[model samples]
Target: MHLSIGEAPNGAEGGATTATRPRDAQGTNEPAEPGSPSQTIVTFADFGLDPSILKAVAELGYREPTPIQAQAIPVVMAGKDVMGAAQTGTGKTAGFALPIIHKLLPLASTSTSPARHPVRALIIAPTRELADQIHENVKAYSRHTPLRSAVVFGGVDMKPQTAALRGGVEILTATPGRLLDHVEQKSTNLSQVQILVLDEADRMLDMGFLPDIQRIINLLAAQRQSLMFSATFSPEIRKLARSFLKEPQLIEVARRNALADNVEQTVYRVDGDEAKRAAVASLIRDRALEQVIVFSNTKIGAGRLARQLQKEGLKAEAIHGDKSQQERLQTLEAFKQGEIKVLVATDVAARGLDIVELPAVINYDLPHSPEDYVHRIGRTGRAGASGMALSLMVDKDQRALADIEKLTQRKLTVEALAVTLPGRRGDSREFSADAYRGSGREKRGREGTAARRDSSPDRDRSPPARRSGSSPNRSPAKTDPFFSRPYEPAEDAGVEAAAEPAARNGLRRPARKVAALLGGKP
Candidate 1:
């Protein structure tokens, strides 16, 4: 089905028809039709949420519940596991957080004792940035409630986190590695966890955290409620859900790998790699984007692009796996605070970033996976905000662009950006089909023959060497003068000849006359 922007492709309430919509703004669904689209517009009060939670929600100016939130909150509050798939920026965090906090309110301790809080709820995320973002959201939603929450992720000192856990906390949001560390050190306990939420489960799997997730699940109580949420649920994710969640109500607010309706995606065609960079700079400068995130395929590429942009006098910083946690956090903080105008990143920063009102997201290099393209652009156009996703495409990236289009189920409009830079090597050149076949060997053989002829002293005057059994008309073999045989003087040769063949045959004497005629002794 073709889904427009802001339209949910499937029923929000999993397979259930909206026969029973949540209460409306007036605290009643009296006039609305069953399963009417208006029935989905729910307020915080309609969910039978705690008074404290309602007050917090109102104070935060959240007038209406998002599609995922409206459908998911009730299911989670009813104590049923939920597997939710929605487009990014669809309020997935709050969908689970509100219900989790409301459920945990009663278990919160009234006393000031350190042992009062025993980690009743656990939320695991794939990245520290995402974990931190979720922690902030949970804290905001639970502002009026007595529930205490702590965030623990790598890249910072754990002393504060340990102290927070020991002092008592009702909710804990953490990345897998750091959470496992706490578990091993006995700094935190998961046995009392009544609810478990795995946010961005697919991303966790992509980051190779499946084993850690399995180990973490093994530590949780078997009787607890489990929630799995992701942008797209691949086969592996479905398998994981089957193993972890017990008959979860599958709620998909949008199609799998769907882009947000509000995000306008475009592909800018450039000539070559250098032109791609040039186009990025031009777009940012021309459009005057205040806050932008450019995605590269590799960490090194991200760093290099960031540096190159800086050389062009633009404020840009890169965050990737190679960077230390401190560096990444510092860069992120600076970007959020507007100290850095452009943030260049890899896919690592794609899922967890919650930048508000980000103007644009540029794809410096098209992601290998179409799912990643969704996540990358999902960084912007968040919370029903209008944003632009511009991809710098060259001829070589046609495959990636095609994959993205197929996955999104929509054709992206392509705009040609005028590239003045010289085209890359071989881009402007053409060759015959057999240009490279047997060419090098043939050229080398010809060069070797010419070199031998040029360097030989007699090659030009002498005939070519004849084989051993050649025709008899060929030139006779030249003799070597020095090593033919041992030879006697002329007088000795004459005397020997005369003695042996003088009587039998007429023998001619050698004429060594010059010395014999001049000497009396001769």
Candidate 2:
């Protein structure tokens, strides 16, 4: 039986209903009365969740629902589409996972007659790392339930994924690209999907997955419940919600693009790249940060920083899109297990990383977008834990810093560092920090121009050379491979050519016959 916490006036018909405006955990429409002592500690059992789910939640040591879970769980259980916006580390996954598992448990038990379970729930994430993380959570949450779950994404063997799908799973978490590949290959079926969740909607769009997302949506059952969770609700996100969600309850646990209050943010000003590197290494050593994540704007920068830190006797590893899935996973696990002291990563590779009680996060480079700054610092200060966030800033980052301050509405305290550090062996004084800070697009454009110039026909030309047996008057065949045939001297084909080798050998056909075949006068 499903739990009905609230009644929709329009009723749940055709998967459409008048959703209740989102309220705080207290179940009131107005924001929980300011200073209304933190939400009464409520257990998963009180939320009307299934016994199996309750057991799993307890095993995970979740004493109570977070503000987001408290508000979103009931709405989802009541069969309402939800648009939840909360700061990172707010336990949004459980908010939806618990209800989804509850709804699928009965169906899973009754559908045993079928050879394989039809997919009933589908969650799409933007990156492979995030997809894997969510899949792990689903497995943990549904441990006691009979429902089976699987995850699929790129950067791994498709054969294993196909095998897993053949056996069937009730819940599937996947990246957009890999999921679409499965749909096209007939390896998975989405026609029976009853619940759909788009986690990190903004990140998916940023990675150019909007069209793929729409195509996947078209393949699902028309009467399915849709839920979307994002850190911020930009105009694009709102537009996407409109197209997919049917009167989704707007739930915003925190202000848009707001940094967590528990995170103490500060900026350290340095002279240049060398100084920035020195500041990060010094801070890590001085603060005794055991497990910390350092964010860099580029993959190359991340790698260089990691190696440089290692040379300074700190254990560090770099992860980015260029790394294989296995390598990325191994590095993440090592970091979590305290085997690696520091994990350096680019923005795209670090999304959806669920590290518990990560003590600190360092931003080696300020992100171009202010929203990204929020996400970076969010890696720390999760689950009511206190954490520190530090950013290494130079003069070039002034504009980006200003944008961040404007978005968060708070000025970050900047401390100047005057210490000097050893420069790279091959570093030249002529190289400016701005040279390394160019956007990826500009670098690609310059490389493309150089490639075109190098491949030009004129640049590839070599002085003509006479062949050993050919006459000096004879022109060489055109070297352009795209031409239908080699160029020939037109005069040699006229009537005067009748006196050539073929005529001398008495093997030429009569000109009148050729003319008749060609339908021309002789």
Candidate 3:
């Protein structure tokens, strides 16, 4: 059974997050007063970490431990295997990184000799963004100590990563594929890795990284402490645990697929594709979401949504697998800097984003995997701040909605949303996404389709206008009905008349009898 601990309060990342603002216990980053709701029972020092590590934590202004941190630090310090299942944005990174850093301090060295530092702890994440994020957290916690950390992922040249690996790092963070690539090149050594962390293991399975994970594990020390973290403990996740972890401690700060109650979720049922885009635009326009991430199910959908929002005069950008790694980083930086108001992204490509205190999230297309629903909304209402989650649902999304409800164990009410678009005549048409409301798109589509079918087989639906640089009287080619008429036998008038008969049909040249051609000059 999943652990039944109550929902984790926001803004407190004992070990959960690397980026901590003055967040109150409820997880919001707002400053705290004497009587503020935030409460702390233990400080980072209580964990008996190295003085330098505590000093670094103090520099970041973290006092209390998040639930995961409170439960995980001691377990990790004890060198016990752990199976941690928590909701997204619950500070899972800090939960594992800190304790691992403390554990590695006894083996840490100040000497710059390449032999002094070895890959002691290895963290495997599902995506490049996530791998980089975990690496950053490790670096932050180990800053005051002699522990060195580095990250390697795909979508970039390997030379730099190869150099870092060769330079020797105590802690290594990498995505499964890139880690394997480095292993193949013999640039990274995993034989001495004592602590193995599979952060977001479920995502790895979802990404089909099981074989890669197994291969990497085979290269690691057999007796090492294994830690597996995921949002849920699906059957597949459980099987993975059985294969790797040896009687690991189970830690769940939130229930399976649990959502942050701090986030307000609203589902809007819309009409057609155009209406969906308009609904997203209207939501952003009407709600004035200064910084929001809109999630799409496909890379093309993400690009299209971002472009459509841009045409609507909204500052938007798209980030997905198709984009080059540099472009993705630039777009993400712009979004984080508030230069881009909307960041449309597909599921896996966006797996690495960690925005602090983001106010809202919008689902342009409901994800086919229900688990992703929880992950997408978890981006907002983070650090205990109240946030909004809005989803635009269409007729075909009913089953997906049902699956989500079944997964999250909550009944989501579908509401009508009015989306307005500029009409063809400089007017505005406001309509609801509810089908029973009879959106104008249905009527217009039926009429337009019938009109096209009834008129010439190939005719323009656009207004009838002359091309600017074409013939003024230019028209479609046509045929004469007379040419298609059936042949009729006329009475033979006279031999001369027949001999010099006027050109018939489309023939203009005269015809001679077969025998006349026998003459040499005929």
Instruction: Report lDDT (CA) for all predictions.
Output: 0.76, 0.78, 0.78
Worst 10 residues of 1 by lDDT: 1-10
Q: Estimate each model's TM-score.
A: 0.74, 0.74, 0.80
Give the clash count for each candidate: 1, 0, 14
In angstroms, give how far residue 148 of model 2 lies from its true place.
Answer: 0.9
Residue 176 CA displacement from its true place in model 1, Å? 1.1
Model 3 agreement with the true structure over 1-522: per-residue lDDT tens digits: 111112243423333321222334464443323432233325667667778878877777676666777666767877888888765556667778888988888898889887789999999999877787678777877888888899998999999999999989999999999999999999988999999999888889988999999999999988899999987789999999999999887776654566777888999987566678888998887888898999999889888888889999999999998998889888877887888999998888778677776889999999999989988987888666799999998778989999999998998867998777556557666655554456666775664454344333354256567668888666768865445556555744443344343345445565565655666553
Q: In model 2, what is the error at residue 438, expressed in angstroms?
A: 27
lDDT: which is higher, 1 or 2? 2
Q: 154-241, model 1: which lDDT tens digit per residue? A: 8888898888888889899999999999998889989889999998898899899999999999999999999989877899999999
lDDT of 2 at 455: 42
Judge candidate 2 against the unseen true structure and give its global Cα lDDT, from 0 to 1.
Answer: 0.78
- Say which candidate scores most in TM-score: 3
Query: lDDT tens digits, residues 302-350, model 2?
Result: 9989988998899999999999999999998888788999999998899
